[model samples]
Target: MLNFGNMHNSVWIGVDIGTTGVRAIAYQKNGVNLCDSNEFYPLETPYPDWAEQNPEIIYKATEKVIRDTANTLIYKGIPVSGIAISTVMHSFAPANEKRELLSNMITWADSRSVEIVNELKKDIKLTRNFYEKTCCPVHACYPFLKILWLKKTFPDVFSKMKYIYSLKDYVFEKLTNKWVIDKSSASASGLYNAHKMDWDEDILSFADIRKEQLPPVVSTTYSQKLTPDAAQRLNLPKGLPVVIGATDGVLVNVGIGAVKPGQLSATIGTSGAIRMLTKNPKVDKKNRTWCYNLTDDMWVAGGAINNGGIIMRWMRDKICHYNSRRLDDIDIDPYDLMTLKASKIPAGAEGLLLLPFFTGERAPYWNSELRGMFFGLSLNHSRSHMIRAAMEGICFSLNCVLTALKDFGKIEDIRVSGSFTKSTLWLQIISDIFGENITLPQNSEGAAFGAAVLGFIASGEMNSISDTANLIQSKKIYYPQKENFLTYKELFDIYNNLYQKLQPEFTRITTYQNQMYK
Candidate 1:
């Protein structure tokens, strides 16, 4: 129902194929989003520390969203000019040469490849070689090790695999018959070299994967005409350009105008990420932080914690059970109420700390066995305090990532975008935690907008990606309160100390959980 203008004025579609859902949005020439439709699909967790989703499910969602959006556009008498897609990184679905799914896509959070990661560490030269080549550590959170796991454990699937593609690459190929990937997505996969901007043969050797198995590395603006079959499925004109977009995390930085060297973006979506752009590749000595190329010359350096907004949802469903109270009121979401209650509590949640590891920990702590904990809970603490603690805890975790990036380079400011940024209080709290100003985008067009910019550039409608900053603008800025900053600073120290104290306990918990589940 939201219409910016007619297709004659400006028309393009941006599709975001996320872990849980697929969304397609129509946009005007000036970057104003017209309308969007999304289709949801649940992710599967067959075992502890394992996460995955059927590629067919995602593909179906993609088809549904694009078709519905195109139908809506038809209703408005405007044919979409082109389509662009952005997706999460570190997820791969192997396929035969014809591009049929060989198995379910291995997600970034799947730690089933832990054995491979550990084995990779044993060879210091191999570890150093991969880091030097790909600029990504040998972590379980990548397709390289995931492929290795499949090849060793599930040889049938591995042998059947003729082509390897990330979720986005598969979708793009389905639409255009082109096997391609953007630099941003490729660099994060532990298969491509971040500095050299190509697949690292040495690292490929480590994984025992060949160049023939991977998708052709392409720029974000790399485009092709949509196939007739896809055009019929989506009800769009054939030959419309389909731009290759990077991962949603890097596109988020572009969407929020956080492309500057010192400015970064910290997003809290289904998962959380703290990202800053670097002209040169920056690697952490401990291999904790990941360095990914954003463009040929620019790179994104950051860390990811799989538990971000998921923690808030968990607290709402399992802890608060607010939905049970207001089952009839479908209009009001429980998470909004939780956020409202959280805003009432003062900074630091009165000494309550939530370890937000309901799905294990990433970044500084790569432990898959780390369990979520509410340290320092008391009778005096209410549900509101618990909710506040959860929110603050996620921000505090992001602060840890920021601290690591700071060790690598300078961070003068941060731009935050995501569903969580809608809460002004949460933005203020994050600013307080970071001890700096955090700006929110006026309109969160999601990765689609940035991808559209890429599409426009590819189509010769725009000059460059840097010109996108002029189109996107910030709405409000949250400056740190000195008192709240001091409060969070002291509490963050406690947060660090708690991790140190709970390390052994977490390991024990993981060991027991692993035994029980496995």
Candidate 2:
């Protein structure tokens, strides 16, 4: 038997399943960490432009984190109030009615559906009509396009499949024996109606799918009890409430207290995005941004980029001789070494610029055919210059989304989160590029903490989402320097112009590469 604790000491657990890893955090109502655990899994790329993860592997990782965190709290006499979930948006796989996945989970980084997306874009009116209802652009990153790609490529799998499952839905089903999707996850699937708050029938017909084929849509606050199997695995009570939380991007805003209009929440996780909450759902006609649900009454309008910290990961593992942190015998992080070397290089990388579309961009460009490159490379440039330019390119890509949100009114506050927060040089680069002071909260687990907040509300521990603001305290603030800002502004303009001028070349080179590999 465990000792009962004061209500004030009750901890809410939030489990966030991301692209490359899973994080479970136990947070008290006062924004302090009681216990936490993390585990990483591989992103399988069997073919060019394909990104996938085994559903079983990801689920096991999630189970370990949640169990580990729950066990630690149990050992410490800290009572766990409830648990909540957050996951990457748009990760999909086909399944049987029994909810067995037909294949590995297709991640957002996969761009195999570019041809289908291109075909969809050819119909301007139809694309606009779909965007009006779904608030998703005609892009390869969405599940709708992935389904089309699957049908065309793997007819056998498509014929055998009876249901579609997002990553969160799979985990929820395993835990509670229920298959359902939160509104935030469904909204980004490119088949849910943001206005009507359900599956878009027109898109259903367009995909030759039915409402029955997708999980029932529910609120982020929806809660279920753990099943006998899940209860045994986690060593928690069977009746423990498991709140279905929002998607990663939206939840990060909630975690950082950037829930108001004009308050921007910028994230650079496995990917990057710039988001702001709004009272109404809005879509960009230019197809530069996507809008999704945070709650029935709230919407998140923003843009996302495929390349962020992953670029740094590539520079570390592929360019540098260092092995992955886990596999390497070295005591230091390769990222820290890269940052230190990059800080020594002057801004602008001595006239060299890199376009960070390594995984194909999402927001602003929404072009999967785009490929990354270094312009103005010369023998004079060294490894330090190359690293600095790569980091600058990532900030430049994020700035593209910030530029699109100009219609959201001038940003009242800029708050950022993710692993990138630990690197002072990277934060300074962001601050200088945007010419604004960026603030970091004491708690960096934005998505995970947001899920915990939902758990609190669903379990009747908290009254409202807005109550989260008071629990958090500002940690550090990075201010832009005048000289660096001026230099970055000029480079930003050049970055935009370069993409415009070389647009055709991108399409051509991508076509040749695809033909050769595939």
Candidate 3:
């Protein structure tokens, strides 16, 4: 093993295996990010609404990031002490006895099993009992429904499976030669009991899966040394301690140091999330807000919206004409310039409100057939006006979720993070719509940073998880303007009514589409 004494100071690493790529980042104990590396991998969509990643390709890319990072550290004469892994949640795949992936990793974005989700939701005995135990709703994102789809459709693959693992567990197994998962991730799987910290036998029986098919669940601080093979591949010392990490979403909240109660977190990346931590496990009776464990005693209550930045990308490619006029070498990304142009327009976008259900609604409405619309538009509306309205509509969609937390569960103030916070205009919109001040953390490295902090705590360098939160400093805060609060309240009410009014029409369109596919 490389001697740790030669290092300048304690160096920790965090590996975030995301939907698009793998990122390996190194940080110091004081929350300063030193260096980072990233590698992209393609996502496969064999059929409509089916998103899968070749687990082997993802693993190889992850190996490359670590190896390249280690090489960079060696060039700089920096020694690595530890590493941890965090990933997107609820996706699962089958693995053989040798820890090789036997099937494509089913990502959370996949909707191939929507039919199964609909059927399960109709089963009160199954849905009620499962939610009571697991604290998760029966949705297409849940592994239990995915397993059902696999068994009913691909019986041969299901019968030959030795074990089923979430993407998080698969990565951990690759590093440590051990198959185990932490509570934060397990709770999101729909097969785990968030309150009890164990797999729900009732849900497992419903899925017809056994304990042996899943990894053992452990605390977030559980530590294991890396195996010789993994060490060689990553160019790190063998037997280096690696800490079990939480889900990227949970850790993103932590990374921004938003651990205090009522400090809500909103992240907009591949998708959007609005979450906050609470002491007790509380689920929204209507199942609008999802409740999952973040720690042994802490629970996260929030909602995930299916449409986020992806909508902006769609507008950029399929709708925006201004971006087409620019030359290739202008050094301008259409996305940033579009946001800049949208910022110039006034609030409310001149009575225009966009329903950002381009990909269908996930939370609050839960309507799969909902279509996007531009409401209250006039002939005077410009592309900038439409773009600004779309951004506002996205914020309003998030506000719909935040309002639910306040009205349903009585959650208070929220802290915001992710790349979207950099936009002063967007943050102000969020603040005004929610009618609460939004705090932006000084360190927005997010999930990767949170994983490194967990490693630091596991190594006995930090006394408590809160230590990371304390180190965070706020760079800016967005407080709502009282004058516009009433306008937003009226617009939000209209926003809620739009879904109810359009549900029947949406159902008809979806029925036609399904018939066509059939």
Candidate 4:
């Protein structure tokens, strides 16, 4: 068993604001986790193509985790040197100058801006120019399209229309009274110029928004003192340094010490992405991948799938409905129970295949019209077979991203992280599908750990950010089996063929589904 809470000296707090919720972990030097706490919120999908979370609700969840963690540190008499934050990218909401949220947080999974994106793509020159400047694809996930949707949807007479920012800026402003964003988040906004390191006036004008209406972009390591009121609420000392860490996708790589050029990070949480660090800004000419700044010198190139462990969660709660306890009252993790059932099935899932795009798709396709599918389902297939097929589908989708990422360079090592590491079956499945060796970190602390390291670096607790590389270690490695690898490769081809053939059908279904609801 891996001992994650290995004791060490020097305490710093790292807070990660995620899609479903937030987590705060206090850590010591050398990647030792001292204490942590978590709080969860809701992702409400009241309408098709709309995934919304209340910004205030998310901020309250973040504040709760940080407060709980700070109280734990105080109880232990551990004086933390500083705190850092990592937030999800492309999560936007409108607010007034006083920071009052005017709308629900439109998250990365939201595809309500599809029509706006389609309209802009008619002008290929403008769209291509925007992609070249910002390194963000013409997708609904970026605020560039979302801003257009907002302008077209909400009228000035009914809207507050004072300012616009993401949930990260919302949370940060609540804590420090600063209207700013880290470059990592800004670079992904599709309004920021990747080369100039500021907002693009051309895109801003096209989106019908002014520069002053957006948050000022700053470096990933920029920090400020926590406000007196916020500090008191969290029960931490006043004037505590709050480092504005990078996006969660970038920070996860830092957490794992996958800093070298060829070291790749494959993460599956609520969503899945394959990321690699590049020394300079890199944009895919095919518009199949995205590049975001980690620092002025470091950029992350990758693709993200809107589906991941979330599919398994659906299989648990809706398909199988497996309770967490057995008849004998023995406690079992729901995911483990699902995995146990799936392991009994063979590698190919016996002709069962799933598209797994329940919430549209990102990365290579960036198509919002694609819906979920269960193709080639046979009478022989059971819930376990379908579950395993979903897992394989997610892996196959991530492989699409990995293929685009290969353009950056040869990916020598693939490091897998997130809660999915608990399932040996899932790990082996990903390894087989990708036909690559998968390495699991000993601690897999991820974004929170990376955030704390950034806090330490920003607060002078650490001499250099490179010091973190020496702290990360690998725990176990899973190699691809030739038989299963060949099976997955054949199935992967079939998967792509199915996706290509079903495009028009998916688009038709999505249109009728939306029209019916309206």
Best by TM-score: 2
Q: Which regions of candidate 1 fall more than 4 Å away from where they truly are? A: 1-8, 96-98, 122-125, 324-330
Per-residue lDDT over 1-518 for candidate 1, one digit per residue giving the tens place of the 0 to 100 score: 12222344657788877767778888775878777898989778877878889887888889998889889989978767788788988998788877788777889878877666766789997787787777777777888888899889889888888888788887888899987888888888888877668898877876677998887888887778889998888887787777777788777777667766687888988889898877788888876788776666667788988788878777887888866457546677677778789888999899899888877777866655577889888888999999999989999888888888888767777888777887777888889999988888775755777677666666667776676666768788899999999999998999888888988898687767778975
Candidate 4 residues 1-518, lDDT tens each?
11112123557788988888799999886788889999988889888898988888888888899899989888988876677899988987777766577788889999998877877888998788888899998998887787778878886612676788787788888898888999999998999999999999988888777898898998888888789999999998777878888889988888888878798999998999999888777888788998899876788888889999878878887899876656237766778778898999999899888999999998899898889998888788899999899889999999999999888889889988887888899999999999999999876768888888887676566665566676888899999999999999999999999999999899899999889877
Candidate 2 residue-pair clash tally: 0
- Which pairs clash in the backbone of model 1? none
Best by lDDT: 2
Q: Would you estimate the TM-scores of all the predictions?
A: 0.93, 0.97, 0.92, 0.96
Candidate 1 has its poorest 10 consecutive residues by lDDT at 1-10
Q: Per-residue alpha-carbon lDDT of model 2 for 341-445, expressed as tens digits?
A: 999999889999999987778999999999999998999999899899998999999999998898768887889999888888988999999999998888878
Candidate with better TM-score, 3 vs 4? 4
Give residue 290's lDDT in candidate 1 (0 to 100).
Answer: 84
On residues 327-377, what C-alpha lDDT tens digit does candidate 3 reach at each position?
A: 346977787788888888877888889999766666766555666889998
> Local error of candidate 4 at 252, Å?
0.8
Score candidate 2 by TM-score against the native. Answer: 0.97
By the lDDT metric, which is better: model 2 or model 3? 2
lDDT of 4: 0.85
**Would you give me the overall lDDT of model 2?**
0.88
